[model samples]
Target: MPVDSKLTASSEKLIPEKQIAGKLLAHYDRHARTLPWRAPPGANATDPYRVWLSEIMLQQTTVAAVIPYFQKFTTRWPDVSALAAADEAELMAAWAGLGYYARARNLIACARAVVRDHDGAFPPDADTLRSLPGVGAYTSAAISAIAFGRRAVAVDANVERVVARLFAIDTPLPGGRREIDAAADGITPDARAGDFTQAMMDLGATICTSRKPACGICPLREDCAAFRTADPAAFPVKAAKKAKPHRTGHAWWIENGGDVWLERRPDKGLLGGMRGVPTSVWRVAGGGEGDSPPDYPFAGRWTALSDPVVHIFTHFSLALTVHTVRAERDCMAGRDGEWWPKADLASAGLPTLFGKVAAAAMREELPCP
Candidate 1:
C-alpha cells in the first residue's frame, strides 16, 4: 500500500486524540494509581458523596495526606445525610488543621444542599454538578468524569504540568494556565476520556514530575516535545517569585479560672467567619515590629503573656504574641466569644493555629515552638 502522507503528517503534527487516549489507557491499564474512589470492576457501586468529598479534600492537599482523612470522614459520616446532620462544631473540629476554613464551611453547606436540593444525589452531569457549593470547573469535571463516567476535562496542577511539558510551551505558570488548558483540551480523547485525564495526572505526578522528571519511564516520552528537545526541565517556564508580606498582630489569651475564651471571627477577611481566639488588628508597626495591643476585647486586670504564635497566611505572615490578662468577675461581654472549660476546649470550632496557641499557652511554655 502507498504511504498515506496526510496520516503521517497529522501524526507528526499532533498525536490523534484517540491514539493519545489509547496510549494513556494502556498505560493506566498497566499502572493506574490505586485510589479508593476508583470503583472495582463489577462492584456495582458509586457514591457521589465519596467522590465529592475526595475532590474537595484533594484541593491544595496531596492524595497521600487526603487518603487517611478521606477514610476517617467517610467512615464517620458515611453519606451526605449523615454529614448534613452532623453538628457544625463537630464538623469544624473534624476539619481542624485542614487550613482552609472556608472549604469546611462550604463542605457543610454543599452537603446540606445536596440533601435538600438533589435529594441526597450528586448531579452526574458537569453543568448540574457545578451548581453545588464549593464546586468549580475543575471539581465539577473531576466528579463527573471520575464518578459518573461523563466525558469531561479536569485541569488540575498535575494535568497542567503534563500538558505544558508535552507541548514544550514555556509561557510561565498561572499566566500560562489558559494556554495549558487549551492544549489539554486539544489532546483529550473521546472514549474513556476520564481515564485519560487521570492518566495525565498520574504521569505528571509520578513520571513527568516538576523536578527530576523520569523521562525514561514516561509513556509519552517519545511524543513529548520537551523530551525530544532534551530540555524537559526548561519546558515549564516560571515567573519570578515575589516576596511574601509579613503582618504583625496580637492574639488575646483571656483565661478565667482555668477556662479559655474564644471568639468567632467576622465573616470576612483572614480566617473569615470562623471560630478563633480574639486578636488585635493584624498589621505591621512603624518600627517594623508587631503593632501594640489594640485593647482587649474588654477591660480588666489584663496581664500580658510572653512569647507569640507566628502563622503564615497566603499573602503574609503574622507573628502574634500572647498578652494574657486576669479579668474581673464582670468582664465585658464577649459577643460571639465565649469562655469554654480548658478540658472542653476541643469541642468549640477554633482554627488549628489558634488551637495550637491555646494549647501552648495552657502549658505555659516559654516561646512556644
Candidate 2:
C-alpha cells in the first residue's frame, strides 16, 4: 500500500518532503545534543567503531546509563583491534553491571570479526554491517548512515515515535513500524543522512516526546498529522503488553578457608558465560512448596537466608533463595570452579542477579571466606 503523503489538515494537501527535511535540519543545527559518541553537526563523520559501540550500548538502555560504560570501554579498548584482542573474562567483567550479557558476548565476537574479516575497520554499507555479530537492521542502518554517510533510515525507538506522531499513524506498534519506516524513508534527505537521522532522534527525545509533546516549538508542526488534531501525544499507539511471568530459584554460597565456591555458567542460556554460585533451575511451575533444594556441590550444613533476592529480567521476575554453608578446605577440591576470595567478591564481576544473592547471603554472620 502507498503511504498517504497528505497531511491531516482539512485541505488535505501534500506537504513537500524537502520542506520538512529543511526545517528539521535547520532545527538540528541549533539544538543538536552534544553526545560523547557523536561529532558536532556539519563536522566530519564519527568513527565507525564509536558509532557501532554506542549503538550497541544504547540498546534497551538509556543514554545516561551508557555514557560512563562507553567512556570506560573506549578508554580500555580504544579501537577494534584492541577490543578484538581483549581477554573474554576481562571483557565480561568490565561489562558486568551492564544488563543483557548477550550484548557483551556479541561485542567480543563482532570486534574480532571486524578485525579478522574487515581489516580492523567496520563495513561501510548496511548489508555488510548487518553481517557482523549482534548488528541488527536498526544498528546496521545507524552505523551506515552516521559513520559512512550512507543514505539510510535509522529508526530507533525515538525515531519510531516521532514518525508515528508526525503521520498520525494509528496502527499499533510492531505492525505500525512498517508505515513509520516508510514515512521516515520519505523524509530522509539525500544529503546529511546522518544529521537528518540524529535530528529526528533529537526531536523525539526533546520536543515530540511520548507524554507531553511541545508541538508549538516543533519544526514539523505545520506538517504534523497528530498536531493538526491537537492531540500530538495520542499517536504512536501501542498494543497492550502481556503480564510478565514469575519464576523462583536458589543460589548456594559455600565458603571454605578464605574463598567461596563460584562456577562459570554454561556458554549458552540466561546469564551465560559468567561466574556465579551454584543455583537451581529457574522454572515457572516450581515456586511454592514444590521448590526443593538443588544438589550441593559438597556435603555441608546449609542454612537458608531469611530474605530472598528478587530481580526483574525482561521476560520474567525471579526470586532467588540464598543458602550459605561453611565447608572444609578440601571440599569440592576437584570441582569445575575456582574458590574466589570472599573479600574481593565485588571485583569478581558477578551479574546483578547473583550479586544481589551474594549481598543477601552476606547479611548473616558467617566465617570470613
Candidate 3:
C-alpha cells in the first residue's frame, strides 16, 4: 500500500499493533548503526560501565567524536573502580579539549560515588541512576534502558525531532517537550525496549535528520503524519533564542628572555585549575574602564597589544586583548610564577585555544598585531 494510505489506516487505529511492531523491527534490523554500547549478537549482557561512559560522553557531543574518547577512557579505566581511582590531574588532562570541563569533574565524582555508594555497580532503576551526579532525566532513562533493559522513554534532540514530525506535533519545543515525550512513550514497545530506544535514536540521527529528513527511507514513513502533509520540518516548532552575551578580559603575556610566565588558575571559576597566563577578571566590558595591569612586583616593559584573541564559551564570546612584558630572569623572583621555555610550552599542557595564541606569538614578532 502507498505510504499515505497506510498512514491514513494507522491513524484511525485500523492497522494491528503487531504490524507496526513487525515493520519497525524489520526496518531497524536493516539500518541500525552498530554502536559500541549495543549488545553484540548472542552476548549475554551489556557492561554497565561501558554504557554509562558512552552515554556521558554522548551528552552534547556527536558519536563520531565520542568514539575515540570513549575508547581511551575504557582502555585506561576499564570500569567504575578504576575511574574512581583516577588522579584529578590525569583525569582532567584526558578530558582536555573535549570542552565542558565540569562534565569531566562530575564524571569523576559520579564514578567515585558509584564505587562508594553502589559498590562499583551502576544503579538499575531510573530514579536511583538519576541520583548520580550529572545524570539527568534523559541520561538516567537512556542508561537504565540501554544498560539494564528497563523500559524507559529516552528523549534526546534527535528523538524529539523524530517524534514531533511523526505525530505532526506543531507545538514548539521545549514547550512541547512534555507532549513529545508522551508521543514517544505511545510508540515505545515492551520487549527489547532497550533496542527500541536505541532504534529511535538511530533513526533520528540518520533517516529522520533535523534537516532534509529522508522520509522515503524512514521506517515510520507509512505512519508519519507530517511527512504525508509535506511539512515534517514544521512539526518540531521552536522559539527564537536570545543572543549570547559577549565579555572581554586581558591575558598577561609576561616573557623573560625566551621564557614565559604562567600561573595555575583558581580551582572554582572559568578554566579552573588550568595553567594560564595571569589574566584580569572576564567581565561585561572587554577589560572595561579601571582594569589595571596585574600586580607584578618585578619591573618590565608592559607593552599593550591590540587585536584581541577571541574564544566562545557556552554562554558567551570572549575577546581578550593582552599585554606583554619582557623581563629579566632576575626579575622572576618578584612574581609568584613559573618560567617555561617558549619551545617547551606545548608539553606544559596549554588549552587548545591558548595554545593557538601561543603558536601565533611564536610565528610573529613583538605586538603580534
Question: What TM-score do all the candidates reach, one by one?
Answer: 0.89, 0.92, 0.85
Task: Report the lDDT tens digits of candidate 3 across residue range 288-312.
Answer: 5654445544456666565778888
**Candidate 2 lDDT, tens digit per residue, 232-339?**
788888998998998887788888877888988887888888889988878784546786656666667888788888999988998888889998767867778988
Residue 20 of model 3, lDDT score: 50
Candidate 3 versus the native: TM-score?
A: 0.85
Error of 2 at 233 (Å): 2.1
lDDT value, candidate 2, whole model: 0.87
Task: Point out the worst 10-residue segment of candidate 3 by lDDT.
Answer: 360-369
lDDT by residue (1-369, candidate 1, tens digit) is 458987887776765555666777788878887888766422335577888999999898888878887887898899889999988767777777666777878888999998899888888899898988889989999988777767888999888888888888889887998998888888887666567767888887889888889988888877778988767877688888887877777777777776667777765566665677787777754565536645667755555555667777776777777767666434736366677787887767577778767866776633221
What are the clashing pairs of model 1? Answer: 303-325, 305-324, 308-321
Number of the top lDDT candidate: 2
Every candidate's lDDT: 0.77, 0.87, 0.77
Full ranking by TM-score: 2, 1, 3
Better of 1 and 3 by TM-score: 1
